[model samples]
Target chain A: MHEAITEEKWDIVIEPRSSLLSINWKEIWHYKDLLMLLVKRDFVAFYKQTILGPLWFFIQPLLTTAMYFLIFNKVANLTTDEVPPLLFYMAGVTCWNYFSETLTKTSDTFITNASIFGKVYFPRLVIPLSIVLSNLIRLAIQFSLFLLFWFYHLFVTGKISPHWELIWLFPFLIVLMAALGLGLGIIFSSLTTKYRDLRFLLTFGIQLLMFATPVVYPLSLASEKYKWLIAINPFTGIIETFRYIFLGKGDFNWIYLGYSCGTTVLILFAGIIIFNRVEKTFMDTV
Target chain B: MSGNAIEIRNLSKMYRLGEVGTGTLSHDLKRWWYKTRGKEDPFLKLGQENKRDTAGGDYVWALKDVSFDVKQGEVLGIIGKNGAGKSTLLKLLSRVTAPTTGTLKAKGRIASLLEVGTGFHPELTGRENIFLNGAILGMTKEEIKRKFDEIVDFAGVERYIDTPVKRYSSGMYVRLAFGVAAHLESEILIVDEVLAVGDAEFQDKCLGKMHDISSKEGRTVLFVSHNLAAIDRLCSKALLINRGKVVMENTPKKVIEEYSLTNYIPGEIIFEDNRFLKFLSLKQEGNNLKIVCDYDAPTPLEIPCLGFVISDSMGNKIFGTNPNYQPPKTPIKESAKGRLQIEILYPKLLNGRYNLSIWFGDGKVDYVVMENVLSIEIINMINYVRETYATASGPVSPIVEWKYDYKD
Candidate 1:
């Protein structure tokens, strides 16, 4: 029974039928321990020597939120759409953190992990997957901080209270942001393996993408003429939908949500296909 | 069926050997079109087989028409010279790269150690990398945990287990990597020249571990290396690859014997000194051939027989047989030494340069005429025979056969 199970698990002969685009997910599944190890390595090793250690997880989004509140709320006079500036930006920062972190690291996957991937045989997808997962730990910490701030504000105001709808959208929004970032990052990582110039473009591209998303200013504040542009931004709908349910500030346009989710799903599948293809023979080209 | 571990049929791998991106989009499209049409890749045909003899080629058939089977628990050594496609075969077997053509079916999990420390993250500690490398080698976390202590002990890096691999010396890092790799319980282990990096002691340790794993554990091992001694020591069966093909596959003894004989550089036939001799023919003599040049020869000289010797660029005498060993008793009127003709029959030297040392010498005296005359190129006489049968047949061969008739 044991032999049969082992045989059944890796029974398939992986003839080089096609490129990396055609991934054998079953093989990856067989080596899932490696994926888990990579995730653990990224999660623990990132802050191993730091004094603050895992505290930096909360510190990162907290600092970013404070900066956004100062710039977008204090200086730019951007409307928070009735939610407190702290709570307002926390929602945006929480979702945006997952996306940005996933994107930045995912795009650099090939370059950063080139040494390991070149010699070892593991699912290249495991790398991007681990990146997304490692960031998820940080997201959890940041989400806890956001909730703590929300309750503090609510407790102080007495009138402001948590809406149950927003609480439920939290996990959904996190997944959406992760899927979007991971999908795009995988695609970018695959492309950058050959054309490394994409890596340079991504640093600036991510900052520009921030403006495109309604993370700083609410989607409702955008002019109706340019609302389509905000809707076109995949993060805009997820972010707006997230804020609407959580802080009860931003408007949730189902049409935009549909578009964002559609784009996210499409990019996810496309990324998988492209990443799968690139992983197979990338050793040769990379 | 006696549990075949791996069955490879008509396996071939062709590599594009230049700068990868040199082929532009159109060129790529053209190449893709050519490949899609199932045409023989143009790149494979460009290079000569012997890479060391000539300047590097634009491309090579890293592996071509190589086919073999391994039985369960069989330790197969894949041995060859550099650029002989041993690594390519391992890479293909490990699925690091795909074969350009043909198909292979392997029965069990193949953990390929094409390199040690293959998946170790520099930023991660040795402890963390253990799990990482273990997983990359296809071991479960439970499996790694089960053998974690053994792995660390084998690597001998217990004190530095938590230290980042980047901080560790290359030896320590490879030790840790190989420790994890060798300890992992996999059905098949594919190791390529990774042992070449470790020191001799560590190499012996690794070879011992590999031997134990294959013999005791009954796991299949495909080991590729240029070290014939290690291969002979560890492997039950061996395959000798040459120019991307399996030239020989048999018991380790047979494969290594053929390899050594094929690669052996024939030693030289040297002369002690010159003497009063007219003719010395190495070809006329059977196996043993020796001659000396003498200076006190009271005779004239000749071109072909004039004391001439051969040496390498570094002045090592490769071959020079003179007729001076047995000097002529007749004293010449004029104090002139004569030349002697020497011919080597079936000079079994491999292709390389050699210098000839020449001089005139008598029974007890010698004088230099030409110290070194470099002129010799023994191209490999390797026939394209599928199998080179082993026989006690010496360098030169003579046909002899006998018919035996019994009462039956």
Candidate 2:
């Protein structure tokens, strides 16, 4: 009917698959406010009526660090490579908490948010990206708690020396952890949309995965027989590098860090592609 | 400028019926193989039209090759029976799901409110959710800030703005949610039955806002509602869909009329009495209301040359035929029981309820005359190009339209 004039430019064209790269950076940018609000909601909505409120963010890491310190260091005779037990365990628990939270929450993006997602159209990436970003607030809180313990170890006890020169590497390390968790999470979410068989497996898997990383005991305690499973794990390099820079006495290698970085980028890239493809039609399956 | 805000071409959506379990992996693999080989989808060929009553195969086309265009600033009402793909079409337009095939192109942004309070979290306060829902519906934070007061005032929930939405009454919640959606800054708005939510007063307010937005702001609107009166009043044009296909596209008045006629279920009206001769049944045949009667008359009677007249609601005879489209060659003799049938073929009597009067008459006397024997409704009968009823003399309300050429 509109054949008289030509050259129409439409803002949106919806079809089955919009190529392998179905992401629109501009659209995501426009929804940045939504991302910020959702992050705030996640941060604020959980602890509204609790007496301690956001203090639980700090309390949770403190309690886990205490439990791990007692079980692994005191009872099992595990060493922290000459670092303070409280500082080492707290640091491990803080960073590991952020990674696990991001991974688990992002892994179920399609299933948990099916109601809102089915009613409107927005860049679906805003969801997991916000989750990853919001958990950073918890990271900052728990990291400050670890920093207080770091100051006591450095000044009061003088028991451990730190690599202050490598302090600039800390932010990049957190970014690498986020990217790896997000990438793996979205891949699982996309695959599990039709068959949620993975949902039951994911919770137990994250618990076992923490042991694969060096969260409870330092990597030095791993025997030669079980080291490969711990070494190939990308979280090992992050934890070891984190220990090397802050506590000054654990395992850290450039090849290991570089390998982790490469794996993170590759998984994140693959995750984006799969997430983009699945988001278009996940409503039907979910 | 193509003067169209949206153009959908050959859009179709196929859904797998029943429980999808372990066997779906094979279907997915086969579909992928076909895609890699550059062949058409093998499953789309076997999909059945979406009909609720019929037993369908595994695949059903929720929407089948539906193509339509919406002009800029046009309010289009989509009316259809339940499970007739109305929701499917809106879901496609809203991008809630991708089509199995074909394309939908739209200029500017499209904000669809398939349901009110779509992303409204129960824990969030009203003010916070205003920004959240606004952003979810494609508004910028700055846009929401500028329109915040207007939204709150329009919803009339300013006093409860700081309270969590779960604490608010259901009416207040719907008002706030609809307020946020109505304030969305998009070029096209797609609303599906959301107006039926809230009180009657709030519904009128929402309708007024819709009218203002489409007319004053020159925004395109696609409305789907079972409220036919609302559709007729608001929409410039309407679409009637049945069984995954477009049945008609025309003005809202005509489409509504056609919708009634399309969904009408024919049944026998068995309420009549007679002196010695009585009636049997009356039902709708193809383009006619067929009347069948079994009579036991005291004496012989003439045939088809029976008197049949259909009167309008005003008690005036509208249209009828004496022979009722066909006459028998011979007269009826005295019989214990006899059969009589008449067809009111192509009775283009305008859409209204009417009563039928029947009587058996010859040249001199009348035999059996049953007055007001049946009442029936005629719908969508004015399909031709006739303009004779400009000034109807009888008691009637005629739909009117006027056009004029420009003058120097």
Candidate 3:
């Protein structure tokens, strides 16, 4: 066998299968154009043909916030601190929406993109990365709407003031939100490929997850005994951090925030490893 | 050696066939224990060939110990029957799926056009799809912009370039997809059965583009298709796969010859399983080759039983006859058998080895049995023939009838 191998132009050997994370990162980087196009496709095709078009981006968050205000603030007697109710809910909703949409879309990726993946080759990670990016555009539009509401409250009431010190932490909040959503999404996407039972469970699970986070009500409204519950949620830090910056209320617990940040990073790394492994062999199983 | 652009070595891909799911935790723990001890999987003993209706298995190798290198600027054709793992091999090379074992090293960017309208979005316009598909195939935005006009022009959908692709006819969609794929300037191009779409004119244009890509631009190409005629025309070299293994690799003529020989056989060739052979016809007329058949038996036989199988001197079946689709057929009666003769008229087959296998079978079960029955030699080297280009020799030349009228 050794002598025969020497005669061959390219030596051929069968090795034991290794994890797919061992794939060369340099190759994926070279395929970045495909990633960009997938992102562009998600952005354009999603809103292009609709009658409302890009306005749907703003309308979605605005309508969602209005519904929460009517249901949670007025009906359920949820506190919004001293900040205007509209401004308060819109800020929380925009950040929450980014994470929710990213997670929702990423979870469905294996099924939605199966036909393309089955036929051709591109970086499989490109699709999930595009989902995060496409959702960012929506977040930006909603963020602008939040800014408009903040200014209206500022001019009309002249009673509330946003904390300038908390503004320094905005970029960190974005990272925390994106990391948690993308990480959780990839994990769910990988699982759903095999046990399709998770697909139905995931839709119900995201709604439950919303109440666990401080999306509808501010984190300050929680009582002392249940404060531990808020700290345990990885999203607690992201939501609290956003409210602390915009509404100028909510305790800034650096220690819990650090804990949440650490969990987010760890989940992101683990998600990448699992996603890389699933991307290679998912075609066969899927 | 010869500036090889694509190099694949021992590229084996194993798949866990039948009910691929995450098993119970106990199974996982046992598998892990085996892996830790540096031993082969114990459950592997239970595995069976994918073709058989068998019980549970650890894994089955879809591709096993396959190795072949394709040179730069070479157009390599891969031909195989269904379940021969042709698509699996392409998917592995294109990185759509990973090989369970072995290594593949290829230089330069590789783009795969596995089907028509692969990256097209129905809501996006025809023009938008070209850019999207181009980008998916690895063309930069600027490159896509530069080639955009050529793609639209090639698809002949310029009038509806701005209209959403969903509105375009199926033919128009395929044309645009092929146009974008043809214009991709990657170092290697992998195309699989993409020529099966569009009208005849578009197919010709696609072939011309493929020829230009290989000959002029010198990109490596790997094409997989069942169309032997197209493979014979476009491919410089060929690989034949059977049952997930490479059987032969050589010039297109030689590979196709070996392939047709092994895989080609009449359904009725194997009779006595409640089958009786009834009819057979072989003839040559003009430059056109035609086949006609009439068969009947006591028991109802599956009509047009696996069509016709033609072989050569080496006992290799060169061709099989079957309708592309189930066209309307005249019904047959039990115990009724009739005679029908077929004539081949035309530009005679190029000089080569040839034979014929004709049978009327009930489904795969046969009535009339004939294996390597009829044979012919098309002699070449005629004196001062107007159409003579080379010495042509082969089995079966269809005789052509020509008539001329002159007035004095």
Candidate 4:
């Protein structure tokens, strides 16, 4: 029997609320341990029974890059602008995989997590944040493999030159891809709670978006009329900036990069607003 | 108001009836239009009372204007029939879902155990699931670590702590889950029928733990359960909710008595064939139960036997009585229809629901037999013992005289 009767006052007031600025940062901060556990669960539970386990992380991008090289470079004869086919396609594949994987996983947050969310009262944003963080770990592993190939090309062929612009461009491109993926993922997830048909459209839409990006071909190959069409895609600036900084082969423009950053911020805020609104009442409909 | 731990004011929750897909878009548009023009949403006014059997309108209020105050250290039992908004009330208190209208002011950290193993991942080990489940119930990592050994000891699963929960038996799983939940340190604990899991021994242990938490620690507890015996032993006050409304709030004994009297119906059946007896009404007055009927006899009968059987809710016969055991003082006359009332005193039945059936026959041939003609409920009012072992061996609990002789 441990009884301490103090006259401390801590009142919790609950009411019907529709406030756009009700995101409790302090509450989220308090549940940081739960968020870390969720991130660990996501990473560990994914490859529990698989024989290769985390080796699949490296193998996936390796196989995808090889297929892209064979199809685009050999069959379609796409140009890489003096960059080696291995380094060119691997850079694009590694960066795009992080973005697409984060987006796909985060977009299915409400559907895949209805059981946990319906029962508990933790901050709903923790699930998506864990998805993004877990995917970051996978991206780091694959990026190391890409650097292994980069060193091989550097020592054997001497065909690639690393640029000083990479000092700022590399981290900036990674953040841009993460923010963009998270933003769009939450937006689509909020909408998918009401309309499940959108989930079907998202898979094919991501596939089509890769062709619009500069993943297989350099941005310089697009004609002047179609270059704006490709530039409007935020990934174009990120992928092109990645290739230019790492391999020093593609063109990069500050204005297009700034545009992509601005769009990322806008979508992130919009996604947060929509996500906050949906998290409160989504249990009713879902 | 100052000493209250929870104060609910005019709380209500409205849900649309069916198919939340295509029709919701139009309703959303209409609601938005109403908001733009400074008008209330018309659908809110169309809500009916929540009766699952009846289909009436597009909207129903699961809880309607429920207001109550719980004292700082009182144990409150919420008793209700099915679909009586008990779970809805718990959900609102736990913040699982927001109310459509009204407000609740609660003082202290409210930990709700609405279900066992809420966030347990099958792929994770039992140790990891304890942390995960604890965190989901609003406990921090440090708190779980502090009670880690105690939880393992309580669950009696020390040998399988590192094994995946998927590999554990169902009994082990529930034990682990309840062990984690039992250690939650909150000022207010809200539980909803979670004790229905686990074995009888474990359930008794959980009841004792809940009693200790409330009485010893001076914490407020709100428990919703269908086990009237547990409610009688643990709760000081009870609230009876019917059709999404609070009907009564009083001491547990009085409220349970009123609830049983109003909730269950004592059935009646009339025999039109006129071969034997016609049933009238079966009612209970205090510990005395009386069954009234009419016996119409054509010819003079030497010996007519009449009996009534009592069975528990599961259709198991607890006990029965007949006039053949002891003859009546007076016999009925020939060609007379007379009202007969059979009164039994101090039957000493346990606290549970039961159904009554009546039978009539002469010494030579059987005349009439009715199965489950009436249903009645028996509640323990005078006996306040915490532990009653009679519920395990059989259903009937008759008070027999005891005589002890010392041989010294």
Instruction: Compare the candidates by TM-score and give the number of the best one.
Output: 4
Off by over 4 Å in 3: A1-29, B21-29, B43-58, B264-268, B275-408
What is the two-chain DockQ of model 1?
Answer: 0.36
Q: Which 10-residue window of candidate 4 chain B scores lowest in summed lDDT?
A: B381-390
* lDDT preference between candidates 2 and 3, better one: 2
For candidate 1, write residues B123-180 as lDDT tens digits: 8889888987888888888999999999999999999999889999989988999999
TM-score of 4: 0.86
Across all models, the iRMS values in order are: 2.6, 0.8, 4.2, 1.5
Candidate 4 runs further than 4 Å off:
A1-10, B264-349, B353-377, B381-386, B389-391, B398-408
Model 2 chain A weakest lDDT span, ten residues long? A1-10
Q: Return the TM-score for candidate 1, rounded to 2 decimals.
A: 0.75
Q: Which numbered prediction scores highest in DockQ against the true structure?
A: 2
lDDT of 4 by residue, A1-286 (tens): 1223665354677787768757888778867788888888888898999999989898899999999999999999998898999889999999999999999999999989887776667778888988888889889999999999998988898889878656576887888999999999999999998888789999999999999999989999999989999999988988888888889888788888898999999999999999988887677777
lDDT of 2 by residue, A65-179 (tens): 9898889999988888888888999889988999999999999899999999899989899999999999998898889899899989889999988898988999999999999
Give the Å error, residue B270, model 3. 1.7
lDDT, candidate 1, residue A67?
Answer: 96
lDDT of 3: 0.74
Candidate 3, residues B3-91, lDDT tens digits: the string is 67777777777676557455734565787799999987666554444443345465776677788989989999998766778888988
Instruction: Give, for candidate 2 chain B, the lowest lDDT window spanning 10 residues.
Output: B387-396
